[model samples]
Target: MKRRILVVDDQRHMANVIKFNLEKEDFEVILSHDGGDAIKKAFDCCPDLILLDIILPKKDGFQVLKEIRKKTITPVIIVTSQEDEEHKVQGLDLGADDYITKPFGIKELVARVKANLRRLEYLNLPKKSNIIASEDLVIDISKYEVKKDGQVINLTLREFELLKFLALRSEKVFSREQLLEEVWGYEHYGDIRTVDVTIRRLREKVENQSGKYKHILTKRGVGYYFRRI
Candidate 1:
């Protein structure tokens, strides 16, 4: 089955350009010109991924992303002209899987899209053990579910992958660059902030709020690793 993608941008030219390239990559592309329409189509079609823009008619990208995060965990990559650090942080903090500035190369955009989809595919695969348990936290590989103390925890696709990767290799330290390559499959050296944000998110979901016990630990001046406890 071809993976479907929602291309949400107000500019017709930009939308068409993205749609054309994605179709070449064998993806089923759907386009929405406004944030409201994008959200509607997103739920209606439930695309495998979304390429969102910041500026829109009914709502901005942040608003649309907020609403989407409220309902689904679908992978979203913000493709916008907004190059400010604040915008990037805001988008990622709101559960966006990835962020790409405008004037991005088609190869880079497609690479990010494929990387996110690949993570989703990996998460959907059957596992040898089917479930990974560490203390009170449980990760069901077969079902792509995570629960802490019997309570379901919502994690974006990337966050789930990061946590699962670390937990499966409990106690083994991996540098941010190594994680980017292993977990994200980034061929080129990209911003380490991506890993930082994901790690922060994983901690938020899987760690105790009281700081009583930590599942993911940072090695000062080194990298990160997961402990089984």
Candidate 2:
């Protein structure tokens, strides 16, 4: 089955360009020019992936992303013209799987799109041991679900993959670069900050308020590791 992708951009030209390229890669493309309509299409079309622009009429990409995340964990890749780190961080914090700055090469964008979809596909594959539990946290690998203290903890596809990778290794420490290669599945497409953002988000969802149970811990200057306790 050909994967469906929702491309949300205010610029019609840009949207069409992306659509044309993605279609050539055998993806079904759905275009939305504004945030409100994007949100509606996001659910109605049930896209396999989303290429969302930050600037849009009505609600904007962040709002659309927030609304989509409230119910679904679909992979979203922010397509923004802003070069600011703040915007990129905001998108990641709101559950975006990845982001690409504007004027990006069509090849690079295509590569990123394929990479995100690959991760999603890998995540859906069957696992030998479908469950991993430590203390109050339970990771259901087969179902792609995580629970903390019997309550469902919402995690983006990327965040869940990171948690699962580290959890499967228990106390093994991995550098940001190693995680980028292992979890993101790309050595050169993303930076180390992406790992940091994902780890921070994961910790927020699964950790306790008292900071007593730090499931994911930083090793000072090293990197990150999962503490089973």
Question: Would you give me the overall lDDT of model 1?
Answer: 0.88
lDDT of 2 by residue, 44-153 (tens): 99999999999999999999999999989999999999998999999999999999999899999999999989998887777776888899999998888899999988
lDDT of 1 by residue, 1-229 (tens): 9999999999999899999999999999999999999999999998999999998998999999999998999999987797678888788888998889988999999999998898888767666657888889998877778999999999888888888889889999999999988888785835778888888878888888987557899998899998886
Give candidate 1 misplaced runs (Cα > 4 Å). none
For model 1, state the Cα shift of residue 74 in Å: 1.4
Which residue pairs show backbone clashes in model 1? none
The root-mean-square deviation over C-alpha atoms between each candidate and the true structure, in angstroms, is 1.5, 1.2
Instruction: Score candidate 1 by TM-score against the native.
Output: 0.94
Q: What TM-score does model 2 achieve against the real structure?
A: 0.96
Give every collision pair in model 2. none
